[model samples]
Each structure stands twice: as structure tokens, then as C-alpha cells.
Target: MSATIKYDDVETGQQIPAADYPVRRVNLVMYAGASGDFNPIHWNERFAKTVGLPDVIAHGMYTMAQGGRFVTDWAGDPGAVVDYSVRFSSMVVVPDDDEGATITVSGVIDQKLEDKRVLVMLTARSGDSRVLSRARAVVQLA
Candidate 1:
């Protein structure tokens, strides 16, 4: 485990550098295998289009997990997280061909709570669409 991040050191408006999470077709396939969400919308383009989707799409939770990973990785500890939430604003369209999709996530310290906790605001974007909206995380710092 990495060293714990201190809450007192963070300032409001402090920006966490954006992270690019590339999601290729292989990633979707791996996520499907790990998450048990083998919905064709996540792997099979034909099935996705049959369901009226533009192409195979990533699972909402999968994208959310990436957002969480970004924060935790930055904070240096997963246990530091107290709360996290996001609204599924748009779909992450994953095509069957290569070049796939990439979701970029960024964060900022928004609010400081009592007892060494901080509220964070997050944004997740894929292509031109925002996949997660009103994303927030409350973390407990050491």
C-alpha cells in the first residue's frame, strides 16, 4: 500500500491531473469476463445495434470503477475513500474495431469536511460526451 494522503494539505480548487483510461475492445471483453456483465452492448456490436444502440457500450459500473480507481490511485490508498457517487449521464460507446474508446477523468477538491475528510468533484468524459455527471467523492485523509 502507498503512504496515506493528508487531508489538511489539500486546498479547495486543487486540481488532480486528468487521467486517461483507454478502453479498447479487449478491455471491454476483459471487463465482461470479470464483472459478469456479458451484455452484448458491451462486447458484441451486432447485438448492440439490434438493441438500438450505435455500437457496443461500456457498463456504467465499469466506467464508474475507473473513476474511483483514478481517485484512489491519486490519494494513494483505497481505504481513504469515505464516499463516492456519480450520475450516469451518457453512454461510453465502445466499437468492435480497434481504436476503441477512451474515458478521461479529472478531479478537484470541492469541500472539506470535519475530521479530516474532503469532498471531491469529478468529471468523466468520453469522446464528446460526458459519461458521468455530478460525480463526487468524500475521502478521509490521514
Candidate 2:
């Protein structure tokens, strides 16, 4: 937690600083092992192509978690997030390279709800595609 965001200072439509999260093949393998999502499409390029996908892709939940990190980081505490959701809108293609893929996440306060909570709308992108849609998080602020 860097600095606490007070509810009194927060405004609807206020933008949170955007962040970029990088995903590599090793990350996919690790996430697969940890999450038990061992689907080949996440790490096997041949299998991904056989399934009609463009190279290996990052897990949807992995992408969502990155978005979650963005919100929690902004709130300055993971527990500040009361609710979070996102719809998978596009695939995040992970290439077999050092750079891998980058998911850029940005958010804004959409609405201030009751009891010191605000709805945060997030935008996530990989390359030219929007990877997540209807992404939102309800955060509790001090």
C-alpha cells in the first residue's frame, strides 16, 4: 500500500493510473501448475493452433487477476475490493519470446455507492484487442 485513498477525496469518473502487466510462457506454465488449469492452449503452441487459436494464449482468469491487481493496488489494500467482475471479450496471445504479452489495464470510478464504496470500471487490452469487458470492481475506501 503506497497511499490510502480517502472516500472524501474520491469522485465519480476519477481515473486511476494505468498499469501494464507482462505475461510470459514461464508465467503460463506456473499459473497452470498453481491454478490446475493445465489446458494446452495456454502454453502449447501446436495444440493451440490445432484448436484454431493464434499461437498460445494467456488464461482468461490470469488476465482477470491482473485487472484485480490494478484495483487492489489503487485501493492500497487487497481487502478494499468488495466485488469484482469481468467478461472475457478477446484472447491474449502469448508469443514464444522474451517480451511475451502485455495486458494494459486502466480504470475509472464509475459511480459512488452507499457506505464508502465506489464502482470502478476497468479497461484491459492486449495488442489491439480488448481482452476484458464490463470489467468492474466495488472498492471500500477510508
Candidate 3:
């Protein structure tokens, strides 16, 4: 499907509405199963502490996927995203509780490029920690 957002209608520096994704221990377990990462730090709090982490952390790729979801959801089509990348800046600690942790994602249109594409800059934060840095996506618009 084509993107609902047209390149001609978009402006640089426009803000996308922020979205929050909650990460729970069970979600981490499911992600580990699906991804085959199965790393202790991602699922085992004691093991993670033994390894010098504050608590069980979410997988880096899972965190990146949330940022991608934010971009694709805004673009209105997953296929609209032609390129995406991010730098892992901090860990998302998932506590074994009902609230768990939250990853808040927001984006801004950084530049309008040729070929109906735009450069989007993304920010993902969990509490006071900046979970992603240098996050960007190139999306093809209608």
C-alpha cells in the first residue's frame, strides 16, 4: 500500500505525535523466543545483575523495532519505509511488575528529500534514559 502522507504536504520540522510502548518481562520472554536471542540479560533479572546490569533489560533489536513501528505507523504503510537505523544509547530496564517499563517514542520531519522521500528523526526514551540516539528513517510518501 502507498503511504497516506504525501511528500508534497509534509514540511520539515513537523512533529509526529508521541507513542508509548510498554515492555514487560513476559514480552521480553516472548521476544527472546521469537528472536532466538535467549540471552540471560534479556530475561533473567538475577543473571543480569550478576552480569552487572541493574535489572533484566530488553533486547536492543526489540527496542529498535519499536522505533521502526513508530515510523511506519506514522507513514501509514510499512512498505513506505525505505531505510531505518538507530544507535543504542541506553538499556530499557523491565521490572517484573504490572506497570513494567515504558518506551516513549517521538519523531520529527528532519528533511524532505527527492523521490517522494523524507528524513525522519526519532527519539525513544524510557524514564530518564535515552534509549536510542541518531535514530532516523527514510520514508517514501504518496
Best by TM-score: 2
Q: What TM-score goes with each of the models?
A: 0.93, 0.97, 0.96
Tens digits of per-residue lDDT for model 2, 1-142 = 6587889998998998889999999999999999999999999999999999989999999999999999988888889999999999999999999899999999999999999999999999999999999999999999
Q: Residue 132's C-alpha lDDT in candidate 1? A: 99
Candidate 1 C-alpha lDDT tens digits along 65-133: 989998898889887788899999999998766678999999999988899999999999999999999
62-136 per-residue lDDT for model 3 (tens digits): 999999988888888888889999999999999988999999999999999999999999999999999999999
- lDDT against the true structure, per candidate, is 0.90, 0.95, 0.94
Could you tell me how far off, in angstroms, the CA of residue 93 lies in candidate 3 after the best superposition?
0.4
**What local lDDT does model 3 show for residue 132?**
100
- Evaluated at residue 102, the lDDT of candidate 1 is 93
Ranking, TM-score, top scorer first:
2, 3, 1
Of 1 and 2, the candidate ahead on lDDT is 2
Query: What stretches of model 2 exceed 4 Å from their correct place?
Result: none
Pairs that collide in candidate 2 are: none
Which scores greater on TM-score, model 1 or model 2? 2
